[model samples]
Target: MIIESNDERGSVNRSALRRLTGIDAASFAERHWGTTPKFTRSAELSGSFEDLMTVDAVDELISERGVRTPFVRMAKDGRLLEKNKFTGSGGFGAEITDQVDSAAVLSAFAAGNTLVLQGLHRLWPPLIAFTGELVRELGHPVQVNSYVTPAASQGFSPHYDVHDVFVVQIAGSKRWTIHSPVHRHPLNNQPWSDRRAAVERHADDSPELDIVLEPGDVLYLPRGWIHSAQALGETTVHLTIGVASFNDYDIAHHTLGALQEVEGLRAPLPAGWDPTDSEAVLPHVRRVLGDMRRALDELDRDPEALQRITERIASRYDELVRPEPVRPLRSVAQMGALRGQDSIRLRDGVIARVVRTPESAAVVLRDKTVSMPPQCADALELLLGGSPCRLDSLPGLDTDDAVVVGRRLVREGIAVMAGE
Candidate 1:
């Protein structure tokens, strides 16, 4: 769906973003996102289907990947890490080009091996960024991302996610059966990799809900829901857009992190308050909590800073984006990192560490874009999808931002940017 704003200024609108769900974002967050992601059969059809990327476009990606990186595994040990590959019950390494393009590539891979189809957010930047700009309008931080699994499946074991996800099916269909989360607001335990086993150890609730999704369908699975999916027929392709947001918990955590930087916040406790005295500590602690509350209450006070942070974070998603890797794979380690859909709130002109590139990307938050290097035709995909870039790491071009951005991108794994 083509969901741009109608203000005639070519800019995204917060109200419009809220309207996407037929409710304000705040109201949605209060009622959904955190509580439950409202599902709609026509979500993919409602707003902007016409201009979204196509199946043919995805076919080109499979072709292009051959020139860039190896088809690595996205799953391991019957468990799926965020970095592992996924495939169907048929197991991994299934060739599916017949269902995808000129020939079946899935047939070529091993039985249980499947590709990650990673970095769709960068691969199809316009669609994701458009969605992101809309989300930003509503004041919710959004992560632009993507995915396309063949018949085998780019697998992740039955598990939970770190953030909320809205998946739009672009090609074939898939089956989803989500068990209610053991803990909806799971206080992000251990690392994301460890969550799988921990979650598996928890007994699932009765009545797992199953969803059969076809092309053009969309599903919203709130974070922490224990869910599993597999390609339904032939091949399956889709886009999973994860939203990195500031929830009550997130705000408290971020505020805690911000305290290190916001000096007045770090001043020692009340002069007379004694840690040994509960009476004194009570009021002092109350005041401290109130101060923290007030600091976050001001998230929107300085609209410019709010907007800047939004832009900076939004720009982070593009840092590791590039469609095709700028360099061919010389080794498994050469594919530095895949980064994109990263997030930074660029408020107060406070520049955070995002992708540093020799070719400085003039990102337009208000307009939903980044200036790409001219020589890099795939630069847009790389920057927006989180693929590693060569201009910054390949030497001989521009400056240090390129190298820094490239290095950071390679480290993040948002996209595949292999180093020569």
Candidate 2:
């Protein structure tokens, strides 16, 4: 779907999360985010998510999109059906064996299995753009998975996710029963399986909230909340927009991990002490704690340490959330056809930062860093400033040199021709 115009896209990007929750940023941060569940009706949200996905879209993805295993999965009665139940080999020249068989999917869905379309944020175009906006707004990596359940069926048993979620109901209705978390604010590594017994026990308790979600409805669920849903009366589809937030523990992990460079902290424990004996390990633990305390003090006073911590955080963010993709063929053509009079700007959704040193400036990207002479800093700054500018109008370079820089930027995927 054509989501919006450029101006509308910018406006939408800025308020994507707010639009979902029907609350301002401050209200969402103070009340709903990371603390409790929020249920908003169709009248509350800005609009429906029909543009993102639909029943027809689900059919297209299954029958025409060449979907493979893992991306297309089925579950019935809380147990995942084997891939062979819904997948088969493509015939003739295309001989991949794990592709989703539309006929099999039909049969399974008719038998009351829920169809799970995983990683739609990466596979679906509309979601790719929408998910990128959410990532930028939340500073938390976001993912989208759709659950299409047959009438009166459940996808999975009551469980919790390590990542927070905003459930956007796309079509039909699903009744959800949510209970308070047994273990709150779980980290990414802490899956519900770790506390399966507790989760199952909690499912029997009175629910904190029980509601039927219809089209245009949204439900925000913080990580570790025990919840389950069942389609009511008709086939149901909903997008699980998962947000993996960075936590204080992550900060400590990165900061302390950087302390490995300290010789004192890295020293081996006293030769042959028994690790199981508390008294034998106490002194070494005390010494290591003292060293860490001193190292932390040193790090607090060091700007370089702070910078490394920031970089590590950014690196992790980059690893989880991909920026908008560039059209390679179009970029190459634009590069070859470039001229001083052409307009160019940093590509939308490209995460870049310009860092300058005495002799050179570099644009840091996820994959590679593009370095340029210090003289190009001003030009790079203007180009990355969101607004398109005539190549010849760039500061610090002649018209021909500006063209050279423009082509280089396009070639490196840092910038694109204006209107692209």
Candidate 3:
């Protein structure tokens, strides 16, 4: 697999997405996104996920890490075990509320239960890196969960997730049975249980795909695709990378916030309105309808309003990122000692975007936005370029001005001293 960085766009190489899915990103978006299931066989898949997780890692997390209830769950015959079944008080007089009971979990596993480790991307560094790359490539929030099913055991019933998922088989093998979605492109609130009868009838009639996934295989199931898997002969461990797609509803939802600024949208309805009186409510309804149409047209024409919607969607990623811990003393001294030759780079997981206006340019970070004179636009570009650079190397700014700007960024935790 080839993974290259696109420095110009500050985006991951499109080929990386192709390599991961065995299909071009554009093609997948056009043909398969929220529409179908795809199974791609790859022997080289081990390199992509081998370091992300392992059975030993799962065992260690459950036994050592003070993992808790929701993070670690055990299920059998499609039913989840109660928290007390596999949780106990921690040592050192810790509270008994939610700590994992490793022994109980192990016992359950031995008795044919499937152990599920949720949010491994948050707990495991390797998975964090993997999921971060996916997030950058897909421009969507990515979450990871690990399913460790004992031999001849299954975790959940034949159901569908509202979000799309990439299942990577890391160890052992499992037989997967997939059926066409009963409700195509279902939203987050729509689960398979809502259409259980239709799903069951379709599943019974004929499954679209039934195959055994071995180590180094990948399966991509879009939202609403019904599927189930069971361990085959040996234990199975697979990573499910869930992608929360940004749908049209999300766009309208965010756009409505912008619409609220229009005066007509805020007018209250007439008091004591009767549902039976269409004539009484018709005027208000017609006015609001006209407002909605005008708002939509204005939003389509205004570039700034469109940009706001994009920023609103981008900000969701902020919650998934874990910022570097602030080192007050070291960071303070580093800011104070900025030299022309000192190298610096944006801190890991520090998201920054450049906003240009007629008067000035601003560098927007998660916690704050720094506005600077238009003269510093080139320097700001280099600083947010996802690469290390010395203060003296910025294109437009003089040495003194470069130092000033770099110091401000470093002081604000947006950038950090490289090689420190």
Candidate 4:
């Protein structure tokens, strides 16, 4: 969407993405939107005087309806810190349970204590919309994972988020260390359990910016900003909007999705064949396995799927945050041939470069990411990421231009079915 880069003020508006090292939200986001970790401070990436998510209609819609779910061991504290692991029990005596964490951790927060929040969007819709709006305003797809902490008997220990974060100090004053990126682009998309270890490895580089943020103030940390916080007074509430990027590791995961679809690939091995009988293996069997490997090579032909997969991932991280923001897409439509589609917009999800397809009405998510039927592509192209295509007549999907646009959507995840 034509993000403005290399500006003098060291900040940016939603229209043009500005890039400042400490203020590099738009530039860095465009580059590693789904891969590398990036962070920006007020001076670095000074956002304009725009009031994001200010509409009463939307603000009310995405407000916290109290913690709709239960707090797990990891979220026992207001901030998700030491107990962030999703696997083994920690020395802190925290354990993971299957109980659903609420949209907002009210019970734990009501007492004004530190706590860990797990998946706020699952129980809330407004938060999801807020996150989605932020992504759209930023002109990028991002997921929204939120964090709200109350000042209590204890404070959160030093830690980092598992994704690139845009912190909106919504309700109270919260302090942050605003550390440097541990790894130039640490994957916050990595499991919560693994984040601390990554941070520990880079703890030596955890330089601090030391800033206190109040409501309406925004703080950004490229995925690995080593920071810690405490309530300014009794409690502090903030929204941490994260964008989980997809890197090579993510590309590696798409293969698993493709394998699930390929029939010959899914077929079971010959009867009685077992790895336990390794001593009885045959050369032909080995060659057959090589053939399967070749199948993957064929699957990787599309250059777009990887980008699509990464963007989808990035958007999910965007749609999970605080109050939903409204994109002026309606204005964009007026400028071009924008027509509304009654498609399912991912609730609390982010997608990028969605376009319409030619033949089927299918919507594809990351056509470059994986294979899909044709009909579903069009809806996806329009619905996912900005298709980067010429906006054409939107009088249904029967015309020639419609077909071309529809095909693009099938490739992206903008629609429900294939493009025709």
Candidate 5:
């Protein structure tokens, strides 16, 4: 299915979500999210998998890149191979534990072991781009892992993931069996192993869905859904993109932290508090609870405070972002060479938004915030539009002021030189 653009602002472009699920984002969220499993079959999606990763690319990462453990793991007959079995000293006198032993990995693969590539989004360029887009669309952190299994072999036992996963069949085919969750809406700390007997029984019983996923098929399983997969006739390669959704616990934790600014909330509890005597602690507890209630009420009424919390949670995911390597001398030279006709664009994965208060305006990106004078508001707005704009074309700033703003953006890694 083709992704269709939407005109609504701040609404998730349903195109990508539709491409994966064959349904609009809103419908999917309303109907299936954390409730059931979904399988979408499309011929167009099969070819798009090649744009994310290929068999040749996988081989290159394993053999030529010297990838080390825990990045690459091998599993056979439901058991994970130890890191020492597939890793060893690096070549050219590098550290003893720095490289993966490609020979050992290939030998294991030939013996019917499934090779699992972890965190491909961090190591593979294609996945980095694709998963980054997924993160922005879903407003959550996304991780990608690839599983290459031999024909007629299974990699792991029946289990459930703590995070929701989109299973993209990239090559060949695999048979997937999905069962009802042993625990509904399980948190990250909950694992299938914690309910091993229940999971085993569920796997043996009737499942909600059982089907062969061919190339171009996408299967989505919410957290805590029991499932397992085995390769079909040909060797199978599939990508599993995990989405870690933020929940109420995260908001509550941040809210508590924000409430720490209240001096009453920061005061220590009674030194001789008696745990068994409710009367002894009643006064102090009542006061503390009252203070917390009032603080939270105030925070809910303050838009700026709520926005700060939202930005904080959003920026926390930026830790997973790997920025482009900046060359000091070259970047400085590029900044100095900027001309009035030169066009610049925001770097990929660099998010910039202008935050305005009555007194001042600030451009916030990732971990950096640059407060600017009120006069630069129009120029900042133009730059934050995220398109290529010539320096001289800024709406309000003159050539000199524009140069200053442009230099600051470039130096702060928010924008890059697009073209002359």
Candidate 6:
């Protein structure tokens, strides 16, 4: 169950989970990852997340950022408040009617609403970096949201998330009441609302863990673990980093999808047979199942089938997570200003693959594909090998040709200049 990753230089990088939980990835994977809950104090982990978030930062985002609906939401007594309560139009030049009204947010907060800042990883700089690192570490897409609760208030009712979460307490204290899962390892399509009766019943049973989380504390809860939290005396702000991990079902789904090309599996059942009659349908079902079993066995032995599955999973990853942010204007400028002395490398967090077709060598990015002459295949490989290389040093191409290729890559968002 141990999770491991290598840097571009092939050295093992420290695991982000270990950094956050003060437990190495091997032990965490063996014991708590997708298995159980583990809570650790701030003193135990590397350090407090004061640099990541704070009360002042929250104020700035609400009052200055011109945030809109879906980004800012408020809840109280386990029910969400209407958007109209804290949202209104920006006057004159900017007329987005649903922008958050800071004054209204203050009034709502005073009335005991818990502010939920969704998608903080995309909004806040520090969280953007941290979440990206965690995604790389776990090979799972990660998202972050912040919960700012007023004293003596609860935001949501007892419920379970479909994704695993690391709850990092940043300010004040909050008491968390945790219970064992009513339905273990629920998928994205399986929500607590689907089984509310069972969740509520389990929530009422004797608690499994109940403790107050002070600033610098963290709680790791696997998916489907029922839990609820209430803010303590002072206001509370915490970040919930959700991990949408791929599982066995995903592998099987892609594998079966590849199997669709098999002729035997696609054959129709007995045309005149009564589907409702057990005697008539049982043998047909068994025969089809036997055919599918044989097809699966053949697929297991075929390397090409495994390659297709890997590509399918990689495509799914491309859809789930975004690469590092690109500055369009700056990057465009850098493209035109490329110099032989400038160092460039593949953009961090980018999902790309160098593919060779009969016609050309192409670098496939999430959003687009950049194609080059077949002569550039070796140069493309050298450029995308993870480490930064100078524009003049691209192996096959001369200085001028190397710059041309480098500029194109930068312009296409496949690579970036060093120190960016």
| Residue lDDT tens for model 3, 1-420 | 123434343223223455457655666777776677778787543134566677788879998899886888889988988878889889777876789988998898899888889988778877766676666667667789999999988888888889999888888999999988889888888888999888878878678999999877889899988899999999999989898877888777888878888887888776788968888889878978888998899899999989988888667667655554457899998899999999898876777888888788798876778898888888778878888989998888888989998888888788889864
Provide TM-scores for the models: 0.50, 0.93, 0.83, 0.49, 0.83, 0.92
Model 6 agreement with the true structure over 1-420: per-residue lDDT tens digits: 245543232212345666678876777888899989999998898666877899999999999999888988999988999999999988998788899999999999999999999999899988887777788778888999999999988889999999999999999999999999999999999999999999999999989999999999999999999999999898999999999989999988898899789977777776788878998888887987788899889999999888989989889988999888889999998888998888899887777778998899999876788899877788888877888989887777788988999988888888899877
lDDT for position 229 in model 3: 95
Model 2 pairs whose backbones collide: none
Error of 5 at 218 (Å): 1.2
The lowest-lDDT stretch of 10 consecutive residues in candidate 5 is 1-10
- Model 6 residue 285 lDDT score: 79
Error of 4 at 382 (Å): 11
Evaluated against the true structure, the overall lDDT of model 2 is: 0.88
Predicted structure 4, TM vs. truth: 0.49
RMSD of each: 13.5, 3.2, 4.4, 10.8, 4.5, 3.1
lDDT of 6: 0.88
TM-score of 6: 0.92
lDDT of 4 at 362: 35
Candidate 1 C-alpha lDDT tens digits along 1-420: 123344444333233343335444455556775667565565523353334556676556555444122232234334443321222222256443222222333443334433445444444545555554555353444554445455746456577776777777667778876777766665545234566555675425443567877766677777777776777655666666666544566444443554455565788976766689888688877887787777766754767646555554445444423222333343234434322322211121112232336775443433233444544323433455433344533333343444444444443333333322
Model 4 score (lDDT) = 0.46
What ranges in model 4 sit over 4 Å off? 1-26, 30-67, 70-111, 115-130, 137-148, 152-155, 178-190, 194-217, 224-226, 232-234, 259-267, 270-289, 297-420
